[model samples]
Target: MSKIKISNAVKKYGSNTVISGLNLDIRDGELFTLLGPSGCGKTTLLRMIAGFNSIEGGDFYFNERRINDIDPSRRNIGMVFQNYAIFPHMTVRQNVEFGLKNRKIPKSQVTAEAQRFLKLMQIDQYADRLPENLSGGQQQRVALARALAIRPDVLLMDEPLSNLDAKLRLEMRQAIRDIQKEVGITTVYVTHDQEEAMSISDTIAVMKDGVIQHLGTPKDIYQRPRNLFVATFIGRTNVLEGEYRDGKLRLDQGYLLQNGMWDKIGDQPLKVSVRPEEIVIADGETGLRGTVLDSIYLGLNTHYIIRLSGGEKIELIQESTMEELIPAGTAVNLMVKKEKINLFTGDGSRNLLRGEAS
Candidate 1:
């Protein structure tokens, strides 16, 4: 197990800077996931850690030693790719043993190690099958087994489950998590899938435009995103534009976000996120009167899109089989607590609402 650290690391391609002086510490024996949309430079960061990509500036350390100059093979970092990178000509056992053989490890020790991980990954039964003879999931298991056979200190995965079906992806997630726990190797996984990262990671770093926006537990990133970009990117968010005026908030359409606890600033335009589940849709209340424009039935929740008095739309979610199902075009009430409303300044950095979760 190892602690991987990146301090002010910068990577440039041509004149474009893909990553700029980023700093992060991945704890020892923990599964840390880098999550973001495509072209966010998540994969580039992963490659830099594995020594597959050079660090043009700053330093990367494995434990206490600086490894910016260490070769990929000597760094003792194992990498698994998006595609099942198994040799089609080699059997599962041969594939797993290939790395050890190249390093001139004892044949007996290599065989034992290969067999051990093949069983651990549950691919021992197909040890003799060629890559094409095995299923996609099985091939991935072989790739994982191969990567783990050498028992590297750090395991790096770049969207390893992207090629598999959804069901297989779920299975691989559990398998990967379980294997990492059993072996206790420090792991860094990269993926664009939020659910996948939130499921298996001990910690997550959400990146945007080659920078780390927020690094925390899945719950932290989802519940208390630091910025509007994070709140809208990491999960679902209903953005409401409003202005703070006289201890109250006026929406785009003149509907007030009433709050008894907060001191409203005078005429400060702000964007607030009202999570769908936090907004309660009900009938017979004079709360922001709106006409229901659409009712979207999500398996366990129904989402109602309502047009307020000033023709602005607000969405709210009702529990499964809500007894008060108002038809579209019917009048409804949108009730949201003040705390659930997240207020952000125009620049999306500083939060205008004091003492509120970021």
Candidate 2:
């Protein structure tokens, strides 16, 4: 029942607008993420949904009801912030019970509800510990438990794992994903980490300068981005210039890629996005020629830096084999996976592929 629909939303600080005429649809029981770099206004949009920021322009709805005028407290939202906001003065149990008490839940019911979420978050053993006594990860668990103890209609998380260490961040992200699926709450998570968003979100809206450049599932955005910026931002991609004419593209490295899909387009310059894994070593001399500049051998894969004949440096990842590594200065020919690569327009504004978003 908590599906959220935002229509032509806008936010401005005085005359400078941050979010301009944005629209988003968040399905019920889905973990949706607003992902972008710092100062991209992802947080600004989250606050708008929480009713903390004033709507300078459009309609905000929760299912059939309008919530633009609703108070933050009355909107029925649970928020977990960057810093573990649990009170130092209260024990974990008290922190979880705080919201229930504020809503005038009976004392006995509050205790039971708090106990339930503590168990759900796997923090029941630390229920009596004050915030100061628990580790950062445990403290975050308490914060999550407290937020869900109220059983709000929607959950909003803003960089909740930023304070945790590398290992704990991974652990906590998995825990959060599991808990969200169990509770089936319509949640909106905001984060700057691309990997974190890709791993946990049902849908992602990649924002830049307050505008959502792409909105789709992780696979769609990563595999076939709508534009050049999105293809580069969502993951590591090698950008190479090319010219398209007669249903074929002449890569800068002197390789020709032909596809019937390009028949409708006129001859023009192109920017190609090829992921590291999308380029493979070809037999004989039937592909783009390059020289290996260096190779870093990881356990399962070896990452190689290559300088193409056209003088462009690119990285490619190949699965490790029993044979010895290809040393630097070795000449190699590479071929791109035609179906996996993306071709953007000359200005990088739009993609020429048919399946991409318009």
Which candidate has the top score in lDDT? 2
lDDT of each: 0.86, 0.93
After superposition, the stretches of candidate 1 with alpha carbons farther than 4 Å from their true spots are: 252-267, 322-326, 352-358
In model 1, the Cα lDDT at residue 89 comes to: 92
What tens digits encode model 2's per-residue C-alpha lDDT throughout 129-200? 899999999999999998898999999999999999999999999999999999999999999999999999
Query: Residue 189's C-alpha lDDT in candidate 1?
Result: 98
Give the count of colliding residue pairs in each prediction: 1, 0
* Highest TM-score model number: 2
lDDT tens digits, residues 1-358, model 1? 7898889999999899999989999999999999999999999999999888978899999999899998888999888998978899999999999988988999899999999999999999999988888988999999999999988999999999999999999999999999999999999999999999999999999998899998889987777678888788876778877778877887655667776655644567788877878877656654667888888887888888888787667778878784756788887766676676777886677555545444
